[model samples]
Every structure is written in C-alpha cells, then in structure tokens.
Target: MTLTTVLLLGVAAVLVGFAKTAIGGVGSIAIAIFALVLPTKESTAAILLLLLIGDVVAVWHYRRDADLVMLRRLIPAVLPGLALGALFLAWVDDTTLRRCIGVLLLVLAAMQLLLRWRSPDTTRIGESRPAAIGTGVAAGFATMTANAAGPVMTLYLVAQGVEKRRFLGTAALFFFGVNLCKVPFSLGLGLFDGETLWRTLALAPLVLLGTWIGLHTARRLSQTRFDQAVLAATVVSALALVVR
Candidate 1:
C-alpha cells in the first residue's frame, strides 16, 4: 500500500472504534474510507477484522444495558438474508450490486424519515414485529454485502426507543455475532490474506484510541442530539453510497 492509503486506513480504523463505542452509524465512514483505498473484496475483509475488534470492546462495555430478547428476535429472519447476500456476492456483478444496495439504503432512509415525521413519538412504531423482521433482514443483507448495515440497524434501534447505552450494547453484540458468522465465508473466499491481516494488526492501536475518544464524546452528548446525529449521518451515508 502507498503511504496515503496507510494513513487513510489508520483513520478508518479509528472511525470504526468511534462508531462502535459512541455513534452507531458513524462507522459507515470507515466503510467508505476502505472502499476508497482498497479493492471491494479486500476492503470488506479488512473491515470485518476491524469491526470484530470494535465489537469486543463495545459488548464488554455495554453488556448489561442491552435488550437481549429483541436481539434474539432478529436472528431467525436474518439468517435467510445473510445466505441470500452471500449468494449475491458470489454471482452478481459489482456495479449492479452497488446500485441495488444504494437504492435499498436510500429507500430505507426515506422511509425512516417519513415514519418519524408521521409520528414524532416513535414508541408504538418501534414495537411492531413486522418492522423488526423487515429491518433485521435488510440489515443482514446490507451488512453481508457491503458492511453497510449501520444505517439500517441504527434506525431500527432508535425507533425502538432504546436509550444510548443499551443501544451501544445491543449494537456491539449484534455486529460482533454477525461478523463472527461471516468469517468462514470470508476465509473460504480467500479474502483474509496475510497482507490485510498485517495491516489490520498495525492499525489496531488506533481503533482502541478512537473508541476511548468516542466513548467520552458520547457520554457528554444529550439523547436528542445523539438521535439527530445518527439519523443525519445515515441519510448522508446512503446518498454517498448511491452516488459512489
């Protein structure tokens, strides 16, 4: 890798930690950074490792705060989506896949906005079973194909009325588990090579540092501000992916 790529990657690693520990959707910035610096396949693999590490720290910090039952309700529906995404990766063309994902995210963001506008109080909407399944499936597919599940998952959790700390805890465990599930396929496809592994190792310290910084920042943020920031970031990220 060139010096510029290395520096960008270090920045990306830090963003991963920050997203995991503090802001849920901000890690999508790391996804965009890696996609900018590396090939699609290599970028996904590198991100997987970094995300797994972040998950560990997040879960460790927020384990007591999450709603384990809600997380569990999401699993069965997610499995089919993951399998479909894996198949799509194996057979679909890259450009088409990107466009499809971009459209999906755009729709998700728009629908979320519409929902909030219709009901400023989101508690009833969050508890709907069908919405959970739909969001979980979409999140599974998005995460598997592009490591872009952050935006979708964030909307679901936020709409569900999860507070900041529980939100962090649930998201941490959720991504950690899904990323772990992705390992065998990533390895089987030869995405986890020595070079990427070394780079991930080299960038590990930045992830920790960023996580620390983000955690402090998150603690100081009001609940309302956190919600707005997450929604805005998700909208921006969806638009970027659509255009990229």
Candidate 2:
C-alpha cells in the first residue's frame, strides 16, 4: 500500500474504536475511508477485524449495561439479513459494491436525521416488533455488505431511547456477535488474505488509541452536536464514493 493509504487506514482504525465507545455513527466514516482506500470486498474484511478489536474494548467497558431482551429479539431477524448480504457480496463487483455502500450510507444517515427531527419519544418505535425486526435485518445486511451498519444500529438504539453507556454496551456486543458470525462468510468469499490480515495487525493500536479518546469525548459533547459533526463527515465521504 502507499503511505497515504496506510495513513488513511490508521485514521480509520481510530475512528472504529471511537465509534465503538463514543458514537456509533462515527464508524460509518471509517467504513467510507476503508472503501475509499482498499478494494470494497477487502475493505469490508479489514474493517471487520478492526471493529472486532474495538468491540472488545467497548464490550468490556459497558458489558453490564446491555439490554439482553432486545438483543435476543434481534438475533433471529439478523440471520436472514446476513444471508441476503452474503449472497449480494458473492455476486457484485467492486464498483457496484462501492456505489451500493455509498447509497446505503446516505440512506442510513437520512434515517438518523429524520428520526432526530420527528420525535424524541422512544416508546412507539422501541416497542414495535416490526421495528425491531426491520432494524435487525437492516443492520445485519449493512454490516455484512459494507461494514456500514453503525449508523443503522445507532438509529435503532436511539429510537429505543437507549442511554449512552447502555447504547455503547449493546452496540459493542451486537456488532461483536454479528461480526463473528460474518467471519465464515467472509472467509468463504475470500475476503481475508495475508496482506489484509497484516494491515489490520499493523493498524490495531490506533483503534485502542481512538477508544481511549472516545471514552473521554463521549461525555463532553451534546448528542446534537455530535450527530451533526459525524453525519456531515460521513455524508461527504459517502458522496465521494458515489461520484468516483
């Protein structure tokens, strides 16, 4: 890889960690970076590894705060989504995957913005079975296809009115589980080769550093400002992929 690519990936690793611990949607920016620098399929595999690393830290920190019931409800729904995503990955070329990822990111960002605008009340959305299933499916497919599920998951959790720590905890565990599940599919798709593994190892420390930074930053910013900053950056990055 060029030095620029390496540097960008390092930055993305940090973003992965930060997103795991601080703001879930920030990881979408990392996804955009990976897709920009690497082949789309390879980028998905590479980021999944980094995300798992970050997930370890976030899960350990917020392990006790998760809503087990919600997780249980979502798991069944995620499986079908995962299957669908894996099939899509198996069929698409890099350019198609890249554009698809960009579009998905834009859609997810829009959903988040709309959710924020329409209501603060979580009860109606959170309690609906259909909503939970839809979120699970969407998250599973997004993660499997592009490693871009952070925004989708974040939108769901926010709609459910998950508190900050609980949100981090639930998201951490959820991604870890789904990502682990994705491993076999990724392997079958030949997404993980030696170079990708080595690159991930080299960049792992940045994820830890970002996690530390996120831990500090999480309590400082108001949710509105945080969402605005992350969403703006993600939209720009996503747009680049679409236009490229």
Candidate 3:
C-alpha cells in the first residue's frame, strides 16, 4: 500500500478502537474509511481484526456491566441473519445490499428517535418481541455484510433505557463474539491473506492505544451528551451510505 493509504487505514484502525471502547455509533466512520483505503473485500477482513482487538480491550474493562437477558434475546436471531448475509455474499452485489442496508438503518434510527421523543418514559418499544427479532436480524445482516452493525445496536440499547456504561459493555461483548464467529467465513471467502494479515498486525497497537483514549473519554462525558452524540453520529453515518 501507498504511504497515504497506510495513513488512512491507520486512522481508521484507531476509530475502530475508539468506537468499541467509548461509544457505539461511530464505527460506521471506520467502516467507511477502510472501504475508502483498501479494496472492498479486503477492507472488511482487515477491519475485522482491528475490531476484535478493540473488543478485547473494551470487554476486558466492561465485563461486569452487560445485560445478559437482553443479549440472550438478541443472540438467537443472529444465526439466521448471518446465513442470509453469507448468501448475499455469494449472489448479491455490494451496491445492491449497500442501498438496502442504508435505507434500513435510516428508517430504524428515525423510528427509534421518534418513539423516544413521543414517549420519553417508555422503554417498551425496543423491548417488545417484534423489535428484538427485527433489530437482531438487521444487526446480524449488517455486521456480516459490511461490518456496520453498531448503529442498529446503539439504537436498540438506548431505546431499552440501558445506561451508557452498560451499553458500551454489552455492545463490546456482543460484537466480540460475533466477530470471532465470522473468521471462518471470512477465511473461506479468501478475504485475508499474508499481506492483509501483516497490515492488521502492524495496526493492532494503534487499536489498543485508541481504546485507552476511548475509555478515558467515556468516563469524562455525561450521559445526555453521550446519548445525543451517538444518535447524531448514527444518523449521519447512515445517510452517508445512501448519499455515497
């Protein structure tokens, strides 16, 4: 890779770490940056390792804060979603799926925001069976297809009235497991090779550093600002996918 591409990927690598440790909705920026820097297929695999590294750090710190029951509800739906995403990899072009996913993210975020605004005291919207199934399936498909599940999970967790720390911890653990499971599929697709592996190894340290910074950032921020920031980032990132 050229020096400029390396620099860009390096920055993206840091963002991956930061998003995993401190926040939820900002990962789409890393996803977009990686796609911009590398070939599309290679970018996803390369970013995957970076994400796992960050996940390890975040999960290590937040292991005690996860909502086990909510996770149990969300986990079952992901298998079917992953299978569908793999099917998409086989027969569907990226452009088609990108458009569909962008629209889905946008709609979901809008609906969640509207619901929260209209009924500030109620968490039932996200806690319902239908919402659980729908968000879980969407998250799995988005993550599998594009490594872009953060916003969906963010909206769901926020809607459930999960506090910020719990949200970060739960998301960190959730993606950590999902990302690990994706390894065999990615290898089968031939998305990672010697060169990409070396690149990922080189960037791993930066991911750790970013996670350190993120932990401090998260600790210092207030809940209201954190929630607002995540919501804003999620919507903007979703729209970027559509506009691009």
Candidate 4:
C-alpha cells in the first residue's frame, strides 16, 4: 500500500474503532474511505474484513448485554437483504452503489428526526410485525449494499428505546453477527482476493488499537452526547457519499 492509502486506512481504522465501541454507527465512513481508495468490489471485501475485526472486539466487550430476542426477530428479514445485496453487488457499479447507500442514510436520518419530533413518546414504532419486517428488510438491504447498516439499525434501536450501554451492546452483537455472515457472500463476489486479504491482514493490528481506544471512549460518553455525535457523523459522511 502507498503511504496515502495507509494513512487513509489509519483514519478509517480509528473512526471504525470509535464507532463500534463508542457510537455504534460510523463503520460506513470506513466503507466510504476504503471504497474511495480501492476498487469497489475490493473495498467491500476489505471493509467487511476490517469490520469483522471490530465486531469481534465489540462482541467480546459487550457479550454480557446482548439481546437475543431482537436479533431473532430481525434475522429473517435480513436474509433477503443479504441475498439481494450479493446479487446487486455482482452487477452494480461502485458509484451507483455508494450513491444509493448515501441516499438511504440521508432518508433514514430524516425519518429518525421526523418520527422523534412527531412523537418522542412513541419509541417502539408499534413493535408490530409489520414494523419489524420493514425495519429488518431495510437494515438488511442497506447493510448488504454499502456496509452502511449502522444508521438504519441505530434508528430502529433508538425507536425501540434501547438506552445507553444495552443499546451499544445489542448493536455490537447484531452487527458482529451480520458482518460475519457477510464474509462468504463478499468473497464469492471477488471482493476479497489474495492481495487485498494480505493488505487487510497487515492492517489488523491498527484495527485492534482503534477498537481499544473507541471502547474506552464509549464508556465515558453520556448517552445523549454519544447519540448526537453518532448522528452528526453519519450525516456528514452520508453527505460526502452523496456528493462523491
């Protein structure tokens, strides 16, 4: 890798580590960074691998607080998304894929704000079957397409009124599961090859370092502050993708 690529990956590593532990919603920035620096297919594979690293850290750190019921409900919905993502990825241009993810993030953010504003008290979005299916499908599709699943899941969890530590932990587990599950599909699509795998492996230590720092920071941030920071970062990165 060139110094520039290494530096960019370093920045992404730090943000990803922070997002996984502290905020639980910034991995997409890593996706954006890698996508910009590498081929789209390779970027997806590389980012997925890095994310899995982060996920392992998250699962280890938050294992005690996982919410199985929520994950159980969402998995069925997510399956179709995974299949669709794999199919689209085989044919879609990188530019189109990134833009689609950007638009989704923006829309999700707006919906989150609007829904909260309209009925701050209505946190669960009915907890009805329909809502669960919708959210799960959206989450799956978004995650598969861009590794941009954080915001959709974040908004859903926020609406579910998952507070603070449990919120972070649950998200950690959910994504850990999802990203791990994505590995085979990504590889099948030729996103991860011998060269990219070696490169990501070389960068593994940095991923660990970032996760450690982010996990520490996460424990320190107040719930309100963390949410705000995550939302803001998501907005900025999402906009960057849109404009790119």
Q: List CA RMSD, all candidates.
A: 1.3, 2.0, 1.3, 1.5
Error of 4 at 75 (Å): 1.1
- Give the distance in Å from residue 52's predicted Cα in candidate 4 to where it truly belongs: 0.9
TM-score of 1: 0.95
lDDT of 3 by residue, 1-244 (tens): 7989889888888888889988777788888777667665567788888898999898999999988889998999887777787777666665665666678888988988888889995488778988889878888888888888899899898888889899988998899988888888888887888987898899999898889889999999899989898888788778767776
Inter-residue clash pairs, candidate 4: 123-159
- The better-scoring model by TM-score among 2 and 4 is 4
Q: lDDT winner among the candidates?
A: 3
Rank all candidate structures by their TM-score, best first, as comma-separated numbers: 1, 3, 4, 2
Compose the digit string of candidate 1's lDDT tens values, residues 21-137: 898778887887887787766787889989888888988988898788988878777777787778877777666666677678778778878888888777677778888888788
- Candidate 2 has its poorest 10 consecutive residues by lDDT at 225-234
Scored by lDDT, model 2 comes in at 0.82
Off by over 4 Å in 1: none
How far residue 68's Cα lies from its native spot in candidate 2, in Å, is 1.0
Per-model CA lDDT versus the true structure: 0.83, 0.82, 0.83, 0.80
Error of 4 at 240 (Å): 1.7
Candidate 3 vs candidate 4, TM-score winner: 3
